[model samples]
Structure formats: C-alpha cells, structure tokens
Target: MMKNNISYIDKVRENILDHLKTYQHSETIYNASKYSIEAGGKGLRPLLLFTALEALDTDIEKGISAASAIEMIHTYSLIHDDLPAMDNDDLRRGKPTNHIVFGEAAAILAGDNLLNESFNVIAKDKNLSAEVRIKLVETISNRSGQSGMISGQMLDIEAENRKTSLEELESIHAYKTGALIKAPVLSACIIAQAAPEISERLEKFSEVIGVLFQIKDDILDLEGNPELTGKNTGSDAKKGKVTYISELGLNGAKEALAKKVSEANSILNSLDELISTAGLRKIVQMFAERDQ
Candidate 1:
C-alpha cells in the first residue's frame, strides 16, 4: 500500500511537470517556478486528494489534473512564504529558496504565475465535466483566497511578537493552513460526486486532519532534525511566532497531536462501511508521525 501511494505521488509530480512545460515561454520565470515545484517536499495536499479519491472508489487518474493544480498552488505559497518580507528562510526542501536562487522579483512573479495557472489548469481540464471543473475552481479560489488561507496569513502576521491564546492560534491556522488542506479533499469529493452524507463526513474528517497537520508542524519545528526536515529548526521561535509548542508547551502539543490522530481515525472508522478507509487511515498516521 505504501509503495502504491508513492507511485501515486510520482504520477502527481509528473503531471505537474508536464503542465509546467507549456509555461516555458519565458526562461527565467519558468525556471524559477519549476525550481520550487520540483523541490522535494512531501506533496501532502495532493496526496490527500488522491487518498480521498481512492476511498471514494473513484479512479485516482481522474484526479491527476486537480491534484497537480493543488500542488502548484501549494508550491506558489511556499515560494512567497520564503521571501524576505515573509518568513525569510535561506533553505527549503534542503536547497536554497526560490528567492535566494532567483531574484526576489522573479520569485514573486513565479509564484504569481503558478497561482494564475492553477485555475487555468482546472478550467481547461478535458477529463472532468464543465460543472465539476467550475466547482473545483470555485472551491480552490475560495479556500486559498481572502476569506481562507490569505485571511489566516494576515492573522498570523498580526499575531507575531504577541502572545496568542489557544483559540486565536487555532483560528489563524484554521484559515491559513487548514483552508488549503481542506481544499484538496473537498475537490476530490466534488470530482467523485460522492453522496452528500459521505461528503459531509469527509469534510469533518478533513477539518480534524488539517488541525492535526499544523500541530505536528509545530512540534517538528521545535524537535525535528534539520537534516531530515530540510529546514532549520527553531525558526518559528526565532520569529516569535506562536505555535502549538509555544502555546501548549512541547509535551502538551504532543498530547494534542495524539488526540487529533485518534479523532481522525474515528472518522475514518465511520466511513469504513461505505468506502475503503485503508488509504486515508494511513494518511492520518503519516500526518501524525511524519518527521519531515
């Protein structure tokens, strides 16, 4: 099963690269964009989309374009996030950040290019129905737009250097990180045309896992090995950013992470009778225990 999952991820990467080939009209912009996209991150969002599709008993192939689109948006966010004006990191995925290699201006444009092309990819996909494609575009835009990820980002920027309550931290991540995490799963449901009840349950499951993701990230930032994570540890604390570890303490954050993992498993159990939960259950475990 793990090997199959890896193969699926490879397919997603290949599809993303194939789509990027068409955008090479400008060499600099293309290289900047491709450099970040090819960076060796886990590609979790697209993996979640594929997992959800598999559980829905839909052909994962049908989700390839949508998966690539989600990954492009994710890569774009990382490029912008690593800029001097933002998180300002020197390394990402074990190499120099896009802005460090490409000029800041080019990196910014690369991010913009990826963001714009993501919607076009969905809109022009021939495999999905017009209605499905429209819905995918709408869902992605809303989740990654002002009311979702961007709003969360604004909240995070505002909270910096200030003591944030648990509620405030959760609210910030729910928008910034959780919103995009939810997007891919919801996109899968839309593509699968699953039953309304099933989709609703999966939506709740996605919410739990989204928070789980951020909590684990907080722990990893503090405790993970830089060699494995491909980024410096303690950068969050250096930035005075409020994370689960900072707010709840290290042990407290681990406890919270454990509870979320349990909640995710319970949700998967509820869906066992309706669809194959094996893949999603593995994903939940991966989210809970990943070192990078």
Candidate 2:
C-alpha cells in the first residue's frame, strides 16, 4: 500500500512538473526557477489537493491547475528558506541549495517570481469559473502571505531561544506549516464545488495531519539518518529550537503522534464513500509511523 501510494504521488508530481515545464524559458530567471522546482521533495501539498479532488470526482483539469499552483508556492518557500538570512543550509534534497547554484540575488528573485507568477497559472486556466479563480487567489494569497506561512516564520524567528508555551508553539506551526498544508486540500474542495460539510471535515484532517507531520519531522531530526531524511539531522538540537520531541521528550512525542494518527484515520473512515483512495489513507498512516 505504501509503495503504491508513493508511486501515485510521484505520478501526480510528474504531471505538475510537466505543467511547470510549459512555463519554462531560456532566460536566467527561468533557469533559477527550474533549479528550485527540480530540487526534490515529497510534493505533499499537491498530492493532498489531488486526493481531495479525486474524492469528490470533480473536474480533473481544474484540480491539476490547483495542485500545480500549490507546488509553485511551496517551491518558492523552499528557495527563500535556504537563503543566508534563513536556515543558511547549503544542501537541500541532496543537491546544493538554490542560493548556492544561482547567485544570492538570482535565488531571491527566483523565489519572488514563483510566488507572484503562480496566480497567472490559475487565472489563465480555462477550466475554472471566474468565481473559483477569485476564491483560489484569495485563499492562496492569505495562506502564503502575512497572516499565514510568512507570519509563522516570523514568529519562529522571534521565539527562537525564548521559552514558548505549547499553545504558542501550535499557533506558530498552525500558521507556518499548517496554513500551506491545509490550503491545497481546502482549495481542491472549493474547485470541486464540494459541500461545506465535506470541506470542514477535510480541513480537520489537514489540521491534525499537518501537526503530526511537523512532529514526526522533529523526531526525525533527533533520530533519523542523514541519508534517509536527505538533510543533516542534528541541526535542530544544535539550534536549540523547541520541537515536540524537544519539549515533550521522545516517548511523549511518539504517543502524541499515535493519537493524531488514530484521529486522522477515523476521519478518513468517515469519508469511506471514496474508499478506493485508501492508498492515500495508508500514506497518511505511514507519515505517522516513519522514522525519517
């Protein structure tokens, strides 16, 4: 189930990459854009959008547009995240980070380009109604902007080396991580014209899974092999960042992860009408159980 789920996700990512390649040009700006996009990751946000849209059996074309847009935004975030002022890591997904390949200025512009130009892809898509396009614009803007991932990053920077309550921690992550994570799922439902009740249930699933995603990430930081996780593992401890594992202890974080997995699976079970996508459910379960 896990292997097939990963293959399905890879196919979705390849489709998104094909769409992205259409926008590619020979310009240096285009080269920088390609660099970051090609940098490998799981493409989780876009996969979530695809899965949610499939669950509704909606317009597949519009769903592809939404998924591709989310990937652009996510790649933009990664480009900026590796800049000198941010994490300053020289490696990402087993390649030299974006800023290292492109000069710092080009890297910055590449990220900026991806962030701003993603809207054009959605707006120009013929499949979506104007109202859906507008709603997607609003949601993606909010999710990627000041009150969402950006704000969470700012809070993360401010709270570093300072004591933060568990509530404060969740607030930061909910915005920084959860906002983008939830956006793809919610945006897909909107594009699919799914009922409000179904959207809310999926949003709940996104919330819990997003939190556990980061929790497992923290655990992997402490215990994962660098080869498997594709990044240095000890940096979190070296940076003195407060993570679920750091705050709650390793065993405690594991217990919390188990509870989240159980709840998330329960939600999936409630949506059993789309039981054919059980591979996605199994993928979520693997996310909960992975060591790296």
Candidate 3:
C-alpha cells in the first residue's frame, strides 16, 4: 500500500514535469524555469497538497492545479534563494544552481516567470470553482507577499551575524518557511471548502510540521552531507545565522523537533476525516529522517 502511494506520488510528479514542458512560449525563460523544476527537491508541497485534499475527501482533480501552482511557487523561491544576492549558492538539489548555469539575469527572469505562471496555472484550471480559485490565488498572494514569505526573508537577512532571541527566530521561520509549508494545507482546505473549524485544525497541524521541517533542516545542515543533501552544509554556521540549533543547542533542538513531530501526529489523528492518513504519516517520517 505504501508502495502504491509512492508510485502515485511519482506519477503526480511526472504530470507536473510534463505540464511544465508545455510552458514553452518564451524560449529562454521557459527553459530556465523547466531547468529549475527538473533539478528536484522532495516535491513535498505538492504531495502535501494532494495528500491533504485526499484526507479531506476533496476532489483530487480540483486540487491538482493548485498543487502544481504551489510547486511552482516553491521552485521560484528556490531560484531566488540561490541567487548571488541571497544565499549565493553554487549548488542546489545536487546540481549547479539555476543562476550559475543560466547566468544570474536569466535565473532571475526564470524565477519571475515561475511566480507569474503559478497564478495562471491556478486560474486556468476549470475543475475548481471560480470562488475557490479566487480564494486560493488571494491566499497565495498574501502568503508569498510582503507580509509573509518575503517578510521572513528580510528578517532573516537582517538577523544574519547578529544575536537573535528565540521569539525573533521563530518569527523569521514562521513567515519564511512556514508560510509555504502551510500554503498547501491551506490550499487543500480551500479546494475542499472545508468548514472554518476544520481548516483551523489543519492550519495548526501544518504549523507544527512546517517548523519541524525547518528544525530538522537546521540539524541536517549541521550534520548532513553535502553530497547526499545536495548542497553545501554548515552554511548556517558559516553565515553566522542563528538557527534552532544555535538558539536551543543540538540536544535541545532535537528535543524540540521530536516534540513538534509528536504534536503534528496528535493533530492529524484528531482530525475528523476519512481515507488513510498513511501517506501523511510517511511524509512526516521522511522529514524527520531526510538526508537532503
């Protein structure tokens, strides 16, 4: 059964990749965007989007476009994040950074292209209700806008090489990392037109997963291999950025990570829903043990 779910997810990824191939209207930007998407991550956001939708008994067709849109937004962020102005990274997902291969200018354009196309992907989907699509788009804009992911990035940049309080650090991650992680769960809720009470529960559940994702990431960066993890490690320490490990200490951060994962599972178990939560449980375990 788990193997079936994994195959299902792989098929979804192939669908996503195939759909990306159709965006060839602009030769350069299209190629660049495709390149970034092809240079894979775990495809966690889209998986979460669909998985949550399934768990909520939402129509998967109506949610697939939104899932693709979420993946696009994530890819765009990665391109910009590896830019010379940001992390200045030379490698991503075990390949040369987008900017490095395409040149910084084209990579920037590619990121912008993905960001805009994300909206188009959602808007053009005829399966989802216009109202739900509108809400999804609005949510994406707000979550990715100045008040959300971008704000977190700005705060993180400001916090670099400085002593930051635990509260401040959490604020940075909640916006920067948590917003995207939360986006899919929220997107699923929107597709389902779930009651406010149910959406609120999933929101809290996703929040725990999002921060745990980052906390585990911080631990991995400190302890993971550049070869296996697909990029340089020790970047946090090198950049003098404060992370969960920095704020809570290694053992302390591990404790916190475990606690959050436990909390997320408790919420998932408590949710009023049907269909197997086996997929989500597997994803959580992956995050907890991911090498990359």
Candidate 4:
C-alpha cells in the first residue's frame, strides 16, 4: 500500500514535470529554471497536498494545480538554500545542486523565477474556483514569506553559531521548515471549503507531522546511509548547525518524535473522513518509521 501510494505521487510529479517542460526554451533563464525543477526530491509536499485533498474529497483538478504550485515553491527554496551564502550544499537528490550547475547569479534568478511562476501556475488553472484560488495564493504567500518560512530561515542561520533554547528552536522550526510542510495539508482543507473545525484539526495534524518530520530528518543526518539518503549525512554536525538532535540529544529527540507521531495518529484516527484515505495513514507511518 505504501509503495503504491509513493508510485501514485511519483506519477503526479512526473505529469507536473512533463507539463512544465512544455514552457521550456533555449535561454539562460530556461536553463537555470530547468536545473532546479529537474533536481529531484521525494515530492512529499505535493503528496501531502494530494492526500489531504483526497481525504476531503476536493476537486481533483484544482488540487493538482495547487500541488504543483507548492512543489515549485519548495524546489525554489532548495535552489536558494544550496547557494554559497546559505547551506553551501554541493549535492542534492544525487545530483549537483542548482548553484553548482548554474552560476550563483543564474541560480538566484532561477529561484526567483520559480517562486513567482508558482502563482502564475495557480492563476492559470481554470478548474479552480475564484475564491479557492485567492485563498491558495494567500496561504502560500503567508507560509512562504516574511511571517513564515523566510523568518524561520533567518532564525536558523543565526542560531547556527550560537546556543539556542528549545523554545527558540521550536519557534524557528515552526516557521522555517514547518510552515511549508503544514501549508499544503491545511491548504487542501481551505481550498475544499471544509468546516472550520475540520480545517483546524487538519492544521494541528500537519503541525505534529511537520515537527516530527524535521526530527526524523535530524536523526537521518546522524545515522543514515548516504547512498540511500541521497544527500550528505552528518552535514549538520560537521557545520555545527543547531537542530533538535543537537539540542535534545538522540534519545530525547526520539522521545519527542514518538510523542508527535502518537498525537498525529490520534488525530488521523479520529477523523472519520480520513479513514478511507489509506495513503495518508501510510504516509504518517512512513514518517515515523523511516530510517532516512
């Protein structure tokens, strides 16, 4: 079931890639644009969007556009994050990072393009209702901008060389990593015009999963095999980057993650609407038990 769910997501992502490639060109902007989009990841954000939409019985065509938009925003973030001034990661998804393939300036421009183009993609999707389209734009902007992911990133960069309290770390992760993670799930509810109570519960579920996801990522960095993980392990410790693992220690981090997983599961189990969304349940389990 889990493997099937993953394959379904991959199919959607492949379709998204194929559609986006239709807009390709021979210019430098085109080259840099393709670099980031083609640099692959697990496409978890898009999967979350689709799963949440399925859980809510949202209009599938609209859900897919939103998912593609979210993926673009996510990919753009990764492109900028791998730049020289940021994480300085040379490799991503088993390929050279965007800045390594494209020059720093081009990579930066590419990131900007993807970020702006996400909205265009959403806007051009005629299947979405006008109201849902506006809400999605607002949700994406809020989650990815000053009040969310961007602010979280600033906190992360600053905390890298300093000691941080757990409270401070939580605030940072909630914004930087958790904002984007939570947005797709919650956005589905909003786009579907779900009940306020249901939407809020979905957000809460997303929060728990988001934090747990980051915690698991920290664990993978410490203990994962690099070949399967597709990125450098131990980069956080090697760079003295502060993370939940660093602040809470391995055992403490595991305990915290377990609590989060339990909380998320409780929410999922209670949502009668989600019982049929077997893919969503499998995703939660995958997050909890994944070694990388």
Tell me the TM-score of each prediction against the true structure.
0.98, 0.90, 0.93, 0.92
For model 1, state the Cα shift of residue 107 in Å: 0.5
lDDT of 3: 0.83
lDDT agreement with native, every candidate:
0.90, 0.78, 0.83, 0.81
Poorest 10 consecutive residues of model 3 by lDDT?
Answer: 1-10
Best by lDDT: 1
Off by over 4 Å in 3: 1-23, 272-276
Deviation from native of the Cα of residue 80 in model 3, angstroms:
0.7
- What tens-digit string does per-residue lDDT give for candidate 2 at 1-292? 3343245555555654565567766477778887777776877776677666666776444676666677888888988988889878787776788889988999999888888778877887788889999999898888889979999888887877878888888898888888998898889878987778777888898888888888898888889887777678877777667788777899988898888888888888887774345745865876777754
- Summing lDDT over every window of 10 consecutive residues in candidate 1, give the lowest-scoring window: 1-10
* Backbone clash count, each prediction separately: 0, 0, 0, 0
Q: Encode model 1's per-residue lDDT on 38-152: one tens digit a residue.
A: 8859989888998898889888888888888888888899899999999999999999999999989999999999999888888778999999999999999999999889899
Cα lDDT for residue 187, candidate 2: 95
What would you estimate as the lDDT of candidate 2? 0.78
- lDDT score of model 4? 0.81
